[model samples]
Target: MKTLRKYLSAEGLIKSIYSKFKKIQDPKNRTGKISLTDCLMSCFAIFSLKGLLQAEE
Candidate 1:
């Protein structure tokens, strides 16, 4: 049950981060304009999800 709760939390957090990523829009911004903060956040989220998957296994 604890593992299930952790998995759900991680999933929800990842989904929220992805939603925020999708919302980023700047017509004048170039590919180089990607926010470093967002990039780091996404990396962290991916790592967290990977850890959670390993835990489940």
Candidate 2:
């Protein structure tokens, strides 16, 4: 249980999660100003914020 608590914390997992996001393949035909990893991370951030907001209610 103690081990689970340590790794499961959002602070601890963020870097690992972001690294995984960077590995995803980009399907865009041409490279744009923004990178695919950034886009995915942005969506992840939005979803995380939404979850936090719902938890507060």
Candidate 3:
């Protein structure tokens, strides 16, 4: 079974980000299909990919 232990790896960093994002309260007046955390993580993923692409150039 997989454990919930935090590690000093990339997976640990992602888990940390997700946990922190969950603490942020949603501010939208109307509810959307996606959750706030999912939106924030999507943005983060985009930026991360952009950085990687730039570094490859």
Candidate 4:
């Protein structure tokens, strides 16, 4: 059996979570070029990777 954390951390599962997160209102004034979706994706990536995101796969 898969652990809950493993199930939740799956790539497909993360994509689904991102889709839902995209609909939420952004606090930023939508000023800079960086989009809210990009911001959220970055945050999620950093969080899911435990802040050790790297370039090489």
Candidate 5:
């Protein structure tokens, strides 16, 4: 959400990156491998949420 925007200048940055990776000739994308979206979301989750959780521990 909005929190991710701090790390990414804009939403288009994420989309453009995803699109570029999608066009690669790698077999992973064609098969059952993870997509660019998953990686991006994971990173976003970590960056946005980890700091808050660590403080509670």
Candidate 6:
């Protein structure tokens, strides 16, 4: 439990969550066929992963 808490804090999980919401609120690319929300969510996840990588440094 301690290790989990440490990981979450050190990794900035809260910032990542907010970033996900921000992405959802933005517009998508020129193609409107795909769901913007879905695309944004995926992008947010990838961004969060990158953030985690940076945080680990």
| Top-TM-score candidate index | 3
RMSD of 5: 6.4
lDDT of 5 by residue, 11-53 (tens): 6665666666556565454445766556665565466666755
**Winner by TM-score between candidate 4 and candidate 1:** 4
Where does model 1 exceed 4 Å of error? 1-8, 26-42, 45-57
- On a 0 to 1 TM-score scale, where does candidate 1 land against the true structure? 0.36
- Summarize candidate 6's per-residue lDDT along 1-57 as a digit string, tens digits: 344453358456755665556566444344566565566656666675687657657
Candidate 6 clash pair list: none
Residues 1-57, candidate 1: write the lDDT tens digits. Answer: 344453357666666676676686755565686575477575665566677557656
- Candidate 6 C-alpha error for residue 14, in Å: 10
TM-score of each: 0.36, 0.62, 0.68, 0.56, 0.36, 0.31
RMSD of each: 8.1, 5.4, 3.8, 5.8, 6.4, 7.1
- Residue 2 lDDT in model 6? 40
lDDT of 2 by residue, 11-53 (tens): 6677778889889888765478988888887777777777755
The 0-to-1 C-alpha lDDT of every candidate, in the order given, reads 0.64, 0.75, 0.81, 0.74, 0.60, 0.59
Clashes of each: 0, 0, 0, 0, 0, 0
Runs in model 5 deviating more than 4 A are 1-9, 27-30, 33-57
Compare candidates 1 and 3 on lDDT and give the better one: 3
Query: Per-residue alpha-carbon lDDT of model 3 for 1-57, expressed as tens digits?
Result: 876548776678888999999999987744878899999888777677677557657
Ranking by lDDT: 3, 2, 4, 1, 5, 6
